[model samples]
Target chain A: MSEVQRVENRELQPERAANQAAEQGWRDRAIVPPVDIFEQDDAVTILADMPGVTPESLGVEVKDHTLSIEGEIAVQMPEGVSARYADLRGSRYARYFTLGDEIDTDGIEGTIHHGVLNVRLPKRDTHRKRRIEIQAT
Target chain B: MFRDLWRANDPLFGDLGRLLRMMDSNWDNVGSADLRSAPRGSFPLLNVGETDEAYNVYVFAPGVEEQDIEISVQDNVLMLSGKRADPADDEKAAGRNWYRRERFSGEFNRAITLPDGVDADRVKASLKNGVLTISLHKRAEIQPRRIDIQAA
Candidate 1:
């Protein structure tokens, strides 16, 4: 009986917690778009899925050493057209982060194709860890 | 009548339509250069297919469940819509420094126009393992047939 009660409590706890979190607007529930990140040896690559967001509808800004990506995708139906189904809506896409001292923002590059965005951030060669050799005197 | 059914039965599709409308209504607000400048457009890749009978498009939308997909066809036009809800939206929203964002959150919608004679009524759609598959049937009038050549 105790075990069952404990399990029940565990299940209810999440709901209660979720309710509380919802009130704060800080729940893991996303009200924003989606994004993916990858790390490379000398740089990091970011890929975000922004369907309907054409190359002309996005914006990236950097300030105070912090990078922010913002944009909007506006899809136009064909002439004399009406939609029967759709999955995307127009909304703001945004993300921001502070860069570490080791990063070289000057070398950063990005590209957008078919609604997919890619950004490359390279790290400074001096900041990269390397092995040193020593010879006996 | 149809709109009512759609709204009650398929909120995802409804949301997709909303997105399309928003984009269309705000065309002047969008710019290719601006969109390219942002990180929101980044994605790995997508898959598409076309056959004599119909065209099939599949998107790798991980974390998207079957019920999340919404597909519809009207007047030989097909639309595919779905959302990969943000994993970090509901709880623990703050205090997490987002070093980078590549996954799409909120809502997503995709639309394609079908060729003449594509059977919108017989169209079928399915979702499996985060992949959304849409099959547009070809109308009988459009299907290629071997007509017998009559001798003059």
Candidate 2:
């Protein structure tokens, strides 16, 4: 039960007038999708559950030691279909993580399959441990 | 450890746990038409709807393949079961440390009681982009029909 701090931009909710006025235009509310993060010896992997997001609608970016992920879900209904018991609806998914210096940002790779986003951040060469040899005189 | 903080005399941490529980309850009560009566905290939340001729059930199950999912209708009860493979099982994920694990893995099952007059034999299911949609057609006798207006 390791606890990881979750940072959410609560003020970004569209319903808040004060927050909305500061933004450029109307923006969809973004929900933070649940994620599982694993730190291997050579790399760190992140798997986020972002259902409804297709590969074309998924975006992952890393800038200024920060990693950000965004996914947009397109909701479509048949012509004759109508919602009777509606609960989960299409929405935006957004999340951010602070990357450490040991991470090799250039080697980072990401993919989305079955609406899940998988990100792998490799460790820099200098960050890997190396054994020092002792000279016998 | 969090247990130590929970037992501490400080009220700040005490209030934090209480607030988290409150938020969970609030989320559970947000929706209006939850007819299944399923217990709270079920993974892969679902949405059920109906049209003139059929009922639509959508299961929000990301990262699951069609082969991993099973859907069946028996005795007017619709059952959905699926497995979300654990990412840690990947060879590249060996010898890793976990900082956070919020996404649910493993198998999950959910059952929903369907309304009468549904044609179980006509049910169809499809998985697209991780969303499993099941359409249960209604019987011909139960489908809504408009009566022709007679000229007066």
Candidate 3:
């Protein structure tokens, strides 16, 4: 009874991203990070790849049935070293999902390990199959 | 020439850069008749740079454990080989229903050629947030020498 869908927006799209530019927008500009979505009997798990992103830089929000994931990748250079080449594509990453009522937003949990972000969304009790008992005559 | 063609489609170099990087990667050395013709796609994309004393390489390989990876430089070619085990393919996810599977998982191999002056034995590697960075020190004899000029 529940479903999760990506919230498509222009900011994540390259050609349409210019409108979202700000003073610090060059580093804030984001591209849609690819994800793997799986559903289990009790909950749905979403895994996103955002390398170079620490837990402190990651953001996960749920509001009005919408879920958003955003983060930035900062290349750390040693004190004497200067950055000369960059091919990580971009520094920012973002993705969004629309949640159905069956999802228990309050019980959601998010964790990041080695730059892989895991978001678990549990299902509501009403959405689970209930076991019925037989009446004794 | 091809660069001009790619830029024509999207001036911002959105997806085109990824495509070009895939084609431009030096991922050859697969066992084949021609070692230079290895297949190219998206897997572990990387970046490279150099400091005055050493050369640096950054590998973007997310969702991987350090124990699963092996790094070495043989014959002046830096090689990185590793296995990325996502549960989707294993017995753990056998009965689970998958709505979408976009992230990649499995074994990966990457190799980049290094200049002759590097000290292969002095290479240093570290992993943080799924990105593995490696630095190869330059041989002392080949380092750039500065002649101090005394002001008269």
Among the numbered candidates, top DockQ falls to 2
Over 4 Å off in model 1, which ranges?
Answer: A1-31, A79-87, A132-137, B1-5, B8-118, B121-152
Interface RMSD of each: 11.1, 13.3, 6.7
Candidate 3 lDDT over B33-107, as tens digits, reads 223212333467666666778878888888888999999897567888898997687676865788878887899
Q: What TM-scores do the predictions have? A: 0.42, 0.73, 0.73
- Tell me the docking grade of candidate 1: incorrect
Roughly what TM-score does model 1 have, to 2 decimal places? 0.42
TM-score of chain B of 2: 0.72
Per residue, candidate 1 scores C-alpha lDDT tens digits across B101-127 of 656576765545545677767776654
lDDT string for model 3 (A31-56, tens) is: 67779998877889899988888988
For residue A4, what is the lDDT in candidate 3? 27
Cα error, residue B118 of model 2, in Å, equals: 1.4
DockQ measured for candidate 3: 0.29
Model 2 global lDDT (CA atoms, 0 to 1) = 0.73
Clashing pairs in 3: none
